[model samples]
Target: MGLIGDYRRLMRAGIALARHDVILPGAYQTRLPLPARIAGRVLRIFGGGARGRPGERLARALEKLGPAYIKLGQFLATRPDVFGAEVTQDLGRLKDKLPPFSMKAARAALAEEFGEADAARLFAELSDPVAAASIAQVHKMSLPEGERAVKILRPGIEHKLMVELSAMKRAARTIEGISAESQRLKPVAFTETIAAAMMRETDLRLEAGGADEMHEISHKSGHFVIPSVDWDRTGRRVLTIDWIDGISLTDPKALDRPGIDRKKLANDITQGFLTHAIEYGVFHADMHEGNLIITPEGKVALVDFGIIGRIGMVERRFLAEILWGFLKRDYLRVAEVHFEAGYVPASQSVGEFAQALRSIGEPVHGKPAEEVSMGRVLLQLFDYTHTFGMSLRPELVLLQKTMVQVEGVARAIDPSHNIWVASEPVVGSWIRRSFGPEGAAKLVAGNVKEITNRLKRLPEVMDRFEASLEPPAPPPPPPRRFAPWWGWFGFVAILVALGIWAAK
Candidate 1:
């Protein structure tokens, strides 16, 4: 965007924050220098003051900025690793709920995405939007042959997102230049992540793809179910999936009315996510109460794949071992996982780190299994990582945020829900599957198989390496220049000395 556009957006954001009384007063106070404070005070004379808590004001301001900023704020709420607990909780209130655009606009978006006006004919019904959020909205609709839910991208969300996103990038750049400490957080990289996620979200097609993959993984799992995508009606701007009929986990009264076992429901949600994280290595990052539903038959259904977390084998192993270590009160093992994963700086003695881990773990270990705070334990672990300069993994940040959200939902279902206690069975199974004799045998077999495959490709690998080692062609000769006799003599003398040294 141009400078004028950026100014307009910044002005819009400032105005909106003022209007909604949503400002992170404490954070802003600490962040701004004295000069900035004086300037801010003067500006506030013109900009107006917010009316509520700083955190609330901050969330409202982002929501007012537009869909992209709203989504950014939502993502930020999940990362206590970045903003801390109080601020994250405040931002969590920035609901995606927004007023719906006209049906004409929704129809036009569908027509454009599906490449035909008759595209609406594909769905048995495409009623008015039931729920509207920052990037997309949900409608109670039907597939060509059966019941389904249609998620449609908000009309012109792309253009609005681009405008807001460009402004964000500019703001991040300016902030980076101003704050030396901001470099570690990588404001620029954060902007890139926001941009990338918003771009993917703007295209409903990507959400469909994510749902499809998750569905395959969760298909036979008894604890969770991912709604199947109705590909016939899915496109760039719209996705159709089987409509889930269940009560929100937050609604305990309703769950009870339907005879849904609260404890079982809690387990299903926790263990379900665990299955995704450990077994599939792909998991939904947003598991807030609104996104998760409990079917009458007691199955947990998950939606909203806009933000997902992925872990590699190494990270998953580290996470598993860390959790297992904590479960067994093996603080040393937990510290070792941090070192092995390169999360803790080598300069920080492992013994010291282990002692710190014990500080957090020992108190919890004495408590009954049902009373432990797994999320708090994880938070302490992350705090240690931050203290030691571990580069925060964005995926882990999302995972932690979702874990907190899941805890809230679970606690709402059953205040005494012991996540660590519930998780032990699942974590134990994963550990055995990963480290038991059978698991070790499988590991060895896989390694040997890989070696055999590499040996088969040894000739091809050597050919490529040999080809790469070939000397480069010399550069074109430089234009000849006239030189004095003294220069020539000096060059020749230097060359002679270099040759003599080489021989020596």
Candidate 2:
């Protein structure tokens, strides 16, 4: 099925959501259009006692829809401004877990990747799958060198994702077409971003490269542990990496170890993410508790490289300045950064934007770590996006999403975790290095070097400019070709026939 198939899938999805009372939720029914209100009432009849907050109902509906919807829910969880904090929080709880595929199926996949004989030789001691997610599952295997974790993509997940993503794109387009406000959110672009990320996740090769890069970054930062990739055993559908022995952060007992320092661990989570994003410009975008583990050595180990966030130097500066400005309670500077970054429209008043920022910041100024919710603050800030003519920045989606995840994980590790306090040291250090006198000198040097390079190419540039100044030669009299006698006679005859018909 192509377009028709997408419509069918969307219809099914709509029905499922309706049954869960997710589409035009009851609370907002009165405010909706007459037709929509009637539709919601009719759909709610099929709800079958679907109970909970609208977010909860939607999460369950999406989970029931399958992996692609679950991923969509997770992506939507990042936009607390559009969905609201409670709804997004509920969406955030949408797990990627799925029942593990059969061992026979797993072996078949391995054999397909590496010929049967090679698969047998390599995974002779392959154990049962230890964990399974929507896209893939992991198995522990013993290699000649050491123990390795083998990740295998689900058999038909790629095609499944393709179909669902197509339907989602259609839905996003439909939503945008129907609502003027939704255009600012760029639902189509947002869906495409999700689609691209999901497609990338299907290819284990990309994950392997990301894992290796993060491993190197981890080594430098010494704030997190990243397992080494086993390149020899890796393939498009399979990834083999060193098996990590640790308790997952999701385990309640992960932080119960005698030597574990909760406060330090919490700070490390926050600082480590900032350091990678600001300094290295790359980070593990998926930092949920399940992807993190507490090693026996009392270190935090990061896993799952399927989603990595990268930012260029400009975004790095934007992030650092924004964080630093917030830490300093300089709402004006924060607003300036937003304007400089072009996140807000030029038509918006900078002073008024600063006042809005002050509103978000002032309330949390002296509040205790536990009392303040960064997630709420972020929600409010994003809510102002519409007020200030701000649109969604696709490039910063992952960064924003990961920030919320990091904050949540940190708070879980230590309830009193203060992201602002934890971020100050890292953010401040970066600001000092980047905005200080030394930074100015480097900036000027870079500009002068660029100018020097241009000067060297001046003769080449002048030659092109001079060449463009010359007028084009005229067409050579239509190749001096004449139409055949019959052609002209036929044209004259056609004109005469038309004139005769008109007279008649």
Alpha carbon lDDT of each predicted model: 0.75, 0.84
- In model 2, which range of ten residues has the least summed lDDT? 494-503
- Candidate 2 residue 116 Cα shift, in angstroms, is 1.7
Q: Model 2, 228-256: lDDT tens per residue?
A: 99888899999999999888888866577
Candidates in order, TM-scores: namely: 0.84, 0.86
TM-score of 1: 0.84
Off by over 4 Å in 2: 173-184, 445-504
Error of 1 at 46 (Å): 7.6
lDDT of 1 by residue, 346-420 (tens): 888899888998999887875764567666776676677667776667676777777777777787787778777
- Poorest lDDT segment (10 consecutive residues) of candidate 1: 494-503
Clashes of 2: 0
lDDT value, candidate 1, whole model: 0.75
